[model samples]
Target: MTERRHDREFVRTFFTSPTAVEGEDDSAKMLRRAADLRGLEAPDVWVPDNEDATAPSMREEGAENVAEVVADSGADFPGEIHPRVVWHRDDPAARYRGFQQMLTVADPDRGAVDHIDGFVIPEVGDIDDWKKADEALTLVETEHGLDRGSLAMSVIVESGEAELAMRHLREEVGKPTNSLERLFLLVDGEVDYTKDMRATTPTGELPPWPELRHNTSRGASAAGLIAVDGPYDDIRDVEGYRERMEANRAKGMTGIWSLTPGQVVEANTAPLPPETGRWLLSAGDRRVELDDRDGAWAYDGDRLSLDETGDDYRLRVGGDERRLDAEQLREELLGLVEYVPSMSDVVDSMEEFEAARESGTGAIAIERAATLRLDGVDVEISSDRMWDEATYQAAMTPIRLFQDVYDHRPDQREELEERYGEDVVERATTVG
Candidate 1:
């Protein structure tokens, strides 16, 4: 497959206070902290809360600190590190001034521009906010004679109206010239949404507002923008935080926001597996033919094919072939099955199972497993059985057993038990 320009590895954002304390430099401290994090991809410095703090002065200090840090530090991180500054949302003119300062203070010789990235706009909720941000960015680019899309931009989606704003952004200002790169979805904003809908419960249990988060995430993905999950407020509940991160990651989020430094390691260490199913081959749309030679398989062109005969089948992809044993085949099949529409529901329900495992909620696991089994029935029926019956059986048998277990179809279960035996059914239902 052709690579997408924006496809990047998982990003971990570390947030730091903007202003310095009495005797310490905040920017220096943040840079040192980032250097210590080892795997941190981005360090975001928050703008000062005081309305009196001048944007140019703050930008000067931030830029100077970035330059000093890069000069002092060794070449440890591979890519360019852009220390981003969080812009003040209420003051559009000040935001414009900050970008101007960023350009002015940038030292080309020292690579200061490479280290000091761009701006992050928080709490973006409407078309007006987008317009103001766009205007400020435009002004900064024009004033400084900077190239369009020179700087990266991130916006926070924290309110109910964010979905509309996101759609507007996708249409009006996207890609090439647009500086907007990331959209952060904060969970705390769900409270505001609940309040707006009058759906808040007395027991502190709110409705499943994940649909809002999903909407924002899907919108970002469709627009080819990075969707970042907001920080988890409960610092003590690391497990809960990781669960939410995993769920969001499965839904296609590229990064997670962290409130504390401790969460950075966990966030950065989260496994982000590359997409691994399906392959397209051919020269000018001509289908390549696979020929079986002895126990191995060979393709006419530089394409890949899976040898399905032996227990340890070899899969060839673009001149590379690797032997996959039974267990590996099982794993590969599970991943491949996700592409099938009939199995997608089961795959989605598996997320709940995983989240429950992380949260230590045993009851939810059982419930989700039951749902998985019910969905598995649909998967079994819709799966193609005519082509390569053994492979088809390999893929669908587990799904059938999973369905039989929770489906409680006694006759069907008994028939499958007689055919496949009790041991096979138990193994398939329990683990598949």
Candidate 2:
């Protein structure tokens, strides 16, 4: 079966740290905490400066030394958790050496290379640097007998030139390599970027770098790569951190680097927009309705037409269409609802959900009920029944008002308050 991409999708809380002794154990402890956090993917432990001048002479020895410390600290966790070592970007030959050392320590039993997932290259100022890093990594992989796609690589976009380089690499040259998966935006690069832009503010607030943040996100998305926001340096300012995280999340960033353990919870708990829930529901419904039969199917103003040709099926969905075998179609359909739990599982877990299912309500109806309950709306009846019953509708009057307020349509809110009492406007807006 084709792996469901949604299985890989979640709030990525990457806890990064320098390889220093003072907070090394503290960092590991946070990694363990992150592993246990619900709705969070495996934590990424990023160790920078693996190939720099101050790094150990033998890269394999350095990796093993770090592994020993990680294990000794009792922070090791199962699943996809892995450490990414950052390589120096100035010299391709040095990076190649580091990659070779990284591979030499790839002993699954020792939890060395097995847990060392990828490498990060810092200060990639142009497409040439990116291409060179790719070539160096590829050469190392070839020499060490590592699979070409086994290790993921990410570049740090720390300056204006680095941002432009990313755009050029994506548009002009394509991905530097197949293994390069993410472009990390270092918004707080102290030396080159901050100095060049004169971004420091007198008030000491987070600098207004909307252009940098937005462009980094756009460039990553355009290249089909994950965009990771840099750490918020002011760890004590929780509210300010949250605001910045929300801004980045809105800009299509998949993840953010957490400089401290305190930031992880806020990072994980950041609310997705209400529209995301709506899209998931719509997509789930479409997936459930998909069948192997060759015919036209329509849902949510989108149409999917399937035609059988020999052993293959030509499937057309909206503007994009492709041919695939029956197995492939099944996998495609499954991918859409991979993140969504099965209706049976939902019913088994929640009494309200079970009651809704027993009443002959569909998945979408149950989803609506669950969503409403999560939004603090009391859902005693199934969504379908609530729509039909006048008394139930009366009970949901406040909820509908609040939803309208949350939706933020001025015309709709004006009409709603005029129809219902204006008192609802205050109640709706203030309830949350």
Best by TM-score: 2
Q: What is the model-wide C-alpha lDDT for candidate 2?
A: 0.48
Cα error, candidate 2, residue 35 (Å): 8.2
Instruction: Give the 10-residue window scoring lowest on summed lDDT in candidate 2.
Output: 371-380
* Candidate 1: residue 353 Cα off by (Å): 27
| Model 1: lowest-lDDT 10 consecutive positions | 369-378
lDDT tens digits, residues 111-198, model 1? 5555444445554557666556655656655665666556555565656666566666556544555445433222234544565567
Q: What is the lDDT of residue 285 in candidate 1?
A: 33
lDDT of 1: 0.47
**lDDT scores in order:** 0.47, 0.48
Name the candidate that leads on lDDT. 2
Could you tell me which residue pairs clash in candidate 1?
Answer: none
lDDT of 1 at 252: 58
Clashes of each: 0, 0
- Residues 1-432 of candidate 2 have per-residue lDDT tens digits of 111111133324556543322225443333334344332233333443343312354344445555554444323442233344444556656566656545544434444555555566666666766666666566656765677646555666766667777666445433544434333222324334564566777875556677777887777656655566776777898988887877876686646767665675566445322211221312413543322112212233335455667887676665678887766755554343222233222222243433445697543232222311111211121123222233333334324323532353232344445544465345444432
Task: Give me the displacement of residue 332 in model 1, in angstroms.
Answer: 24
